[model samples]
Target: MVKHTKKAVLLTLLTVNMIVVSACSTANTSNQSSAAPTNDAKATAGATGEKVTLTYGGWKLDTITEVIKAFQASHPNIEVKAENTPYKQYFTKLETSAQGGTMPDVLLMNGPNFIKYADNGMLKDITGNIKADQLDLNNFPASLVSLYSLNGKNYGIPKDYDTIGLWYNKKLFDEKGVAYPDASWDWNKLVEAAKKLTDTSKGIYGFAAPMMNQEDYYNTILQAGGNVISDDHKKSGYDQPEAIEGLKFLTDLIQVHKVSPTLAQMTETAPADMFTSGKLAMYFDGSWAAFTINQNQDMKNNADVAVLPKGKKQGVVIHGLGNVISANTKHPKEAWEFVKFLASKEAAEIAAKQGGAIPAYKGSETAWLSAFPQYHAKAFIDMTAYASPYPVSKNTSVWNTYETDILKNAWTGEKSVADAAKELGAKMNQALAAEK
Candidate 1:
């Protein structure tokens, strides 16, 4: 997701500055008043013992609506107002609301953007709130819990998690007389299978390496024994020899081996579309795709999932969404209560039954696995043992943009992999330096 920036207007020293200051104050007050619950409203709810309405801002309209209904069923005194936005626009809306002190009472937070919001004091500090409400942090994986925390302060509760996996078209494998992927398959085994599966005359390719981070190169980087950023978040690891080797492996698939679609080819057709259309044999994608894939008759009958093939070691990238309350919310008590319920096992089960992304709460995955009995859903849950948390630092979007833009040159064969990595490493380090 992209970060949103608001345009600033220049003002003169005396008259213009006075007018601009007054205008901003008036606008901010007006926005906050309209966006949040009023003091009189809260008092009325308290005095009359009536239901209190809390606005929830997030993506995933269907799943969130289901979950909210469930919450309302149990908590009759609270009503949730969902302000759904597309993933692409969610952050932009959030950034604008936050600037105006008009953010919703609660919102979904992704790992890559969590630090930016938490650091800026946009999120409520829920460390004490969680304990006071008796919410079980033990229910979530330690890795995910750590992912949403900054400097010992917890700003969010893990909602759902996802991991990368290898998705293959069984029809193509059967046609070619090849076995399906399994734990025994390694990077070399995958390449061999891709070679046998590719049939140019039929307009089918074995795989697609689209220079994507989460489902593609990030896992490869970790499996190849390379890190994206230093553990301290103080340095970039792209220039390391192991990191370059990881990147080269992907570029080789597109430019050298010819078993995967070229960057140009994937540009014309998304890898997911190609796989679903039977134009690709094998693809790498997230577990979240299972919901849509299961709904496709052809895919449900002909496709299955497996653990991502190992490189030097078995690895995959894992990321999750966190539900957080707004620091500026007028009703902290009501918001905290809602956030607490949202993190509970009951809420997670609602998400699982709807086939939303894998619920982060332990043992809740069984419900999700059962939601799609036709596919190998267990592969995603099992991958957590060897998974690496999705890489991020403060201001991840800044360096992430650099990573994607510079690496495209290598993916397109316009620059050598090593040269591109070297340039990216320098530029990324520069961005990292500016974070603090």
Candidate 2:
């Protein structure tokens, strides 16, 4: 849920010089590309006599910029300009803008980071803006929308959602004489397939066990019947027997099983890159990675997805962000109108069809699936039945950053799992206490 596709997307958008953003739009927000106009366009002022110019901050500058331009087309009186920047730096920009007292009129807030901004009184309460009275709350997925709400107040609009699944190279399975992955597959089956597929002589491995919070590690945690964060979001369960055993699976792959490359080797050659280049046979990734995998010519033809092997409970990770209007927006009404329009059923459908991410609105992903046929993306559909939101707490960012780093060190064998878990638990408990 760390937007695993982002690094892959950015890598392509910057290095490959492809991943062309074909601007497409409806009567409302779209990805249509056009030159920004210097002149202000406005429709007749609704209740206020003033025309307004709105600014937005989002990592998807190209996509959002197009939507804003088209927004001006429909509401000719309101002009919206967006500053697009790299996803890695968008939060720093948001914080800097917040400090300057001029944060964008509409700010982007992901699930994990939203609690910090909303709880600190940096956001406007938009519960009234999005009324179950006006719109059907049923259109959006429950888990995704709930992630943006805290204590009955909605601070962000759920834009898109994605879940994790196992991506396999079909060619590898064929060469190894192993059956394709399916729901019947379990942990032992996966470990056995991994062993059969791994061949150091051929320089191919079965899995990539990078210690990321989401893709590999979180799935492992859930598979071991453990929660990454406690229900109350206080203290650390990182040291729990199940959680440590979950993490040990990865270390087992490298140190005990000798299938995956050591953590050092994985660091030098990132897992995503390795999987895309055919060096690895399988990977756990989000639906968004379809864009990157499909765009990569080498693996594009051979890649496919399957439901991940089950643990005590079948699990998948869901993640997305909500559209939030600034607490101090001069045109709060217009901003809300725009937010509703972007989050509307039509808008979500267009977003799904556009090939960027899956829309959280009900029934939108059907179109997204049709748009890409070769991958047989239904594993994602199957995942929705049991998917869980990425866990977040008051100080989620603080705790996870430390916990994941220590876990990574543990995976690489720099420290023992027991020792690392205790250290991680102590730091996480301290972070949670400070949040309290």
Candidate 3:
């Protein structure tokens, strides 16, 4: 079942500090020039043969291109200009745009950043628009819808969702004469398999246990019955015994058992790169990795996935990106039309067949599963039965900074897991408490 939060109180918790500029300012004059008709004027303008152009911004350039082409084919009067930004700089660009009142008419937002944007009055309240358009919310999971909502108003429509899985090198498993991981395998089973598969001489480790939150330790923490943040979003759970156990599990794989590469080794080669290069036997990764793996001829043939091995119980962290609109957009009607179309069954089918990630729309997963028939694609969808929402407080980015810096000590063995976790908890609590 998906969790829910009461409407977030509008708080002055801005993740990015920028000088606020009004929409009418000189900085946004160019933005205002591109404004199309208002919702009520849209139909009349269309009848008079007016053309509307919308600037759409996102990190998924390739996928967005395909989606835009499909959208424009049917709605010939609407033109969409794609603004692609690399993920590393995407948020920085977006915040800058928001500050200048030059944000895109339609923008893509991920779960953690959605609340930050919505609470800051940067996103449109699309509840009335959605109701007026009669777009079916039933197509998406309630939990997913909840993720894009704040204080009972919808700010975005979910585009895709992801869950973590154990991606393994099938050739390595066959060479080692070990059975591939299955539903029956637990944490102990995974460790035993990793030990058998590790080859120090070949510089190949059994696994890649990078200090990542979503794809690595978070699942273990949830499976171990630990929370990242309290249900009320008022406290941190890093210091909890189960949460610490989860962190230690991954750290031990590097520092003690040596079944995974150390932090220094991974710095030389990223875990994903190592896995793709056939230097790692097993890696915990997200469903989105399917597209990357499938693109690589060598890894595509050898890689397969399994449900994440059970910890104390089966668990995986789930998150997705949503399509949002700028609150200051002049073409509310055209923007809503585009967003509604993107959330429709037609768009979901196109995305599913692209094999980038699973569409959040219900019943569209079959296409995604069929996109790569050789791999165990069903494992990702099936694991959703025990998936946990990606943990976030109102000030997620602030606390996330604390998570990475403080947890690195434990990951690198500079500090004991208990000590590092205790410190992380204290700092994280301070960040959460600062949020309204």
CA lDDT, every prediction? 0.78, 0.71, 0.79
The model with the greater lDDT, 1 or 2, is: 1
What are the per-residue Cα lDDT tens digits for candidate 3 across 1-436?
A: 1111211222223324322110000013223324423344445444466888888888766764677889999988889998988777777777666546677888888777776667756677899888887888988866678778888899999888888889999999999998999999898999999999999999888998998888898888988889898766789999899999989999999998899999888878889999999989998998888878999999898999999988888888888778998776767777888999989888888877765468888888998888778899889888866677677666687877888899999989999999999999999888887776
lDDT of 1 at 358: 89
Give the alpha carbon lDDT tens digit for every residue of 139-186 in model 2: 777777777888888887788777788899999999989988988988
User: How does model 3 fare in lDDT?
Assistant: 0.79
lDDT of 1 by residue, 1-436 (tens): 1112211211011111111000000012224335444331355363456778888888775775787888788778888898888776676666656556567888888887777667655577888877776777989877788888988989999889888889999999999999999989999999999999999999999888888888788888888999898876779989998789888888888888898888888988999999999999998898878877888877877999999998899888788888888766766677777888888888888888886778899888888898778888799888988777777776776777788799999998899999999999999999889877
The worst-scoring run of ten residues by lDDT in candidate 3 lies at 18-27
Clashing residue pairs found in predicted model 3: 7-151
Which rank order by TM-score, best down to worst? 1, 3, 2
Supply candidate 2's per-residue lDDT for 101.
56
Query: Candidate 2, 317: how far from true, in Å?
Result: 1.7
